[model samples]
Target chain A: MFPEELKYSKEHEWVKLEGNVATIGISSYAQEELGDVVFVELPKAGQEYKANDEIGVVESVKTVSTLYCPVSGKVTAINDELSTQSALINQDPYGKGWIAKVEMSNPAEVESLLSAKDYQSQLAG
Target chain B: MLKKTALYKNHIDLKAKMVPFAGWEMPVFYPAGIIAEHKAVRSSCGVFDVGHMGLINIKPQTSNIKKAEEFLNKIGTNDVSKLIDFSCQYSVLCNEQGGVVDDVLIYKLIDHYIVVVNASNTDKVLAWLSSHAQDIEIEHLLDMSILAVQGPRSLDVIEELFGEEFGFNVLKRNNFLQVGNILVSRTGYTGEDGFELFIPLEEIEIIWDKVVEMKVQPCGLGARDTLRMEAAYPLYGHEYDEKTTPLDAGYSWAVKFGKGEFIGSKALSKEKEAGPKKRLVGVVLSEKNVPREGFKLFNGGAEPIGEITSGTFSPTLEKPIGLAYINNSCHEKNISVEVRGRRVAGEIVTLPFYKHS
Candidate 1:
C-alpha cells in the first residue's frame, strides 16, 4: 500500500521529502511487481540531478530495469550497504531499502510527482 | 496484445503477472517469487500452462510405421526401431543437413501417434512432418492444451486431485490413462517426478482452478525456465536449433541407428565418426558478473573459444550459470566466460548446473 504522504511517479518510484532533501526508493509496489530483486545499481553519491532521467539499474531474476529520477536533485547519499545485501529491497522497500538521498536543486520540482492515490489508480488502469 | 487463453481472465483475476511468450499472453508467475515457485515443485506439486506448445496427431497406415522409422533417422532420432507405442521419447527433428529443426516428443497415443512440440517451432515441425509423411494419414490435427504438474510431491497431488484410481505406477511412458476427460501421462519438462496432462482446451480453466484449489501453484515461464535449467534439460531454441546437432547437445543417447534408416542419419553418422566441431557444455561463472546470453567464452589461457547460448543467475545455485557451445577440446579443458569483457573462470560441468532436491 502507498502512503498518502509520499509523492510518486509513473515509473513506480516514490520520493519522500523532508525539507529540501528527498529519500528516494522504489515503491513497495515496484519491488513486488519485480519479483525477487537480485541486484540494484544505485546512483553514486555526488552525481548531478535531473527529473525522469536514468540514474540506476534494478535487476530482477528475469529482467534489468532502469530506475528514473522523479525530481531534479544532486545525489548526496546512497545505501552502499545494499551492494552485498541486495535482498534488503524485498525486505524493506520503504526504510532501509531507500536507494539514495538527494539534495533538491529546486524544491518546486516536487510538483512533478503524482500523489499516492493517483499512482495506485495508474497501476489499476 | 489481445491473445488470451481459456484461463487468461482467471490468471488476471488471481493477480498473475502476465508476459508475452511465443505471441501468447501467458502467466510467468503469481504473487510468490520465482525461487519460491521453483522450490515448491522440488518439494511439492506445481502446475504450468504449457498450452502454448503445438500438438499434432498423425494416423499413419499401420504398415507405414516402418516408413515412420525412416523419418526418425531423417530426424536424428537414430533409435526409431527401438521406439514402441507405450514408449515416450525425446527427439530432435532435423533438416537435410543434420541441423536440429525442433526438439519434439514422439508419443504413440493409441493406433495413431501424437507429437508435442515447441510453440515457436510449431509451424516448422508441422511442415516438416507433413512433407516427409506423404503416405501417412494425419487424422485430427487439433490445438489441444497441455499442462505439466511436476515435482516430487506431484504423484500425491495427482492422487489427491484425480483420485488414486488413475494408476500411479501403471501409467507408463507414452501410455495415457483417462480420468474422467483428462489424459494423464507420466511426462514433464521439469526433471521432477510428475505428469503432463492433456485436456480439452476449453476445460483447461476448470482443471486449473481445481489444481489451484488443491494448492498447486500456477507457475509461469519464469519458474519453468529455472526449474528446467536446474534439471539440466535443454531449451529447444537456446541449446539446440536449426544450427546445432543433438550429438553436440549431449543427447547422443536419443539417437539410435541400430534398427534401420532415417533422415539426417547419414550426415549424423558422418558427424559422429568425425565428431561434432562444437559441443554444448555447462559452465558456472565463478565470479559476480552474470553470464548472459551471447557472452563470449574463452579458454583458461584467455583465448576465445566459444560463446554462451543460454545463461541465467541460477535461483537454486545462487550464482550465475549457463549452457554454451564450445570447442570439444576446450570443453574438456576448463573454460571461462567473458562477461562485459572480463574473463570469469568457469569449470566445464555436465548438463545440469543444479541437481533436483
Candidate 2:
C-alpha cells in the first residue's frame, strides 16, 4: 500500500516533499522487484542530474540495478547509513532507507510525477 | 522449453524464487535465503531435492570389468581400473582433444554401475556412451529420482530415518550402500560430510515428507551454489566444458594414464609430460561487489591474464569470491578483476576456499 502523501516516478522511485528539498527512495514495488538490497552506492552530494538520469547503483546478492532520479536537481545529501546497513531499504524504505535528498530546481515538476493512487493502479495493471 | 522437477509444488509452497538452470526449473532461493541455508548446512543438516539430475543404471556383462573401466579411464591420470562392485569414483569423461564430456560420479552397483550425470548433459553422455559401448548391453538405463542429505550432522538425522539398514559404516569414500531397493552413497558435492540418498522415483515424495519433519532444511540450488563455492567446488559448465581441456583446468589429477589404451588418454599423457600450463585457483574479493562469470582477471601489474570461471556472493564468507584458471607460474599472488569495467583487487589463494569442520 503506497502512502498518498508521497510522489512516485515512472521508474518506481518515490519522493517525499519537504520544502525545497525532497527525500528520495525507491518504492516498495521497486524493492519487491529488485529483491534484497545488499549494497547501496549513493550519489555524491552537490551532484546535479536531469530527470530520469541514472545517478546511483544498488545491488542485491544476485542482482544489480541503477537508481534513476525522478526529478532534475542537485544532490544535497545521501543516506550514509546505507553503506553498512543496506537492509534498511528493505525494512523501512520510505523512512531510514531514503536514498538521497535533492534540492529541487522547480517545485512544479512534482505535478508531472504519478501520485500514490496512480502508482498503485500502475502496479496492478 | 524448460523442464520441471517433481518437487516443483514443494518449492512454490516454500515460497521459493524459481530460476532456470541448465534448462530445468530450479529454486535458486527459498524463504530462508542462500545465506541462512549455507549456514544451516555448515552447522547442522540440509536436504537438497536434486531429482532433476540423470541417473543411468548399467548392468555390465561378466568378464568385461576392463571394458567398462576402459570407457572412463580417459579423464583421470590416476589408475581407476581396480574399482570393484558397489564402489564409486568421481571421474571426468573427456574427448580425444582432452575436452570434458561431463564430470560424473560412477557408482559400481554389483552387476551394474550407476552413472550420475549433470541434468543438462544426460542425453549427451548417453549418446557418447552408446556409440562407444555398443558391444555391451545398455539395459535398465533408468532416470531414477534422487535426493541428497548433506552436512556434518547429516549422519545423525539419516540414521534416525533409515536406521543401520545397509551397514553404512563399512561404506568408505566412493562406496555405495544397497539394502533392498534403496541405494545410498557416502558422496556429495557440498564438501561437507554427507550422503546422497538415491530413492526410487515413486517413493521420493513419501521419503521427502518424512525427512522434512526432521532437522534438515530444504536447501535449494541457491544455497548449493554458495556452499559449493565456499568449499571451492566447481560447477561443470562454469569450470569445465566441451571446449576446456583437462590439463589447463587443473583437473588433470582425475585423468589416469598408466591404465591401458582409453579414449583421450594419449592427449592427457602428452599434457602431463609437457606439464600443465594453467591452473585453477580461488580468488576472494577485498570489496563488496560479487565476482561473476566472465569477469576479466589481471595480474599484479593490472595486465589482463585470465578470467573467472564462476563467481557469487559467498553465503558462508559473507563476501564475494570466485574460481578462475590462471597461469601457474604467474609469479604474483595479487590479481585484479574487471567487475563491470571497474578494477577491483583480488588475491589468488589455494583450492577448496572453505573447509567444513
For this target, which candidate reaches the highest TM-score against the unseen true structure? Answer: 2
lDDT per residue as tens, model 2, A55-81: 888876666778988888999999999
lDDT of 1 by residue, A26-85 (tens): 999888777777777778799986888889878777666689988888999999888877
- Estimate, for each residue in B38-152, the C-alpha lDDT of model 2 and write its tens digit: 7788888888988778787554465576655555554333455667777887777888877788878777755566778898898888878777774455543454677888887
**First chain of candidate 1, TM-score:** 0.95
Q: TM-score per candidate, in order?
A: 0.87, 0.90
Which pairs clash inside model 1?
B28-B220, B73-B262, B73-B263, B74-B262, B74-B263, B78-B256, B79-B256
DockQ of each: 0.51, 0.41
Please estimate how well model 1 matches the true structure, expressed as its whole-model Cα lDDT: 0.78
Worst 10 residues of 1 chain B by lDDT: B67-76
TM-score of 2: 0.90
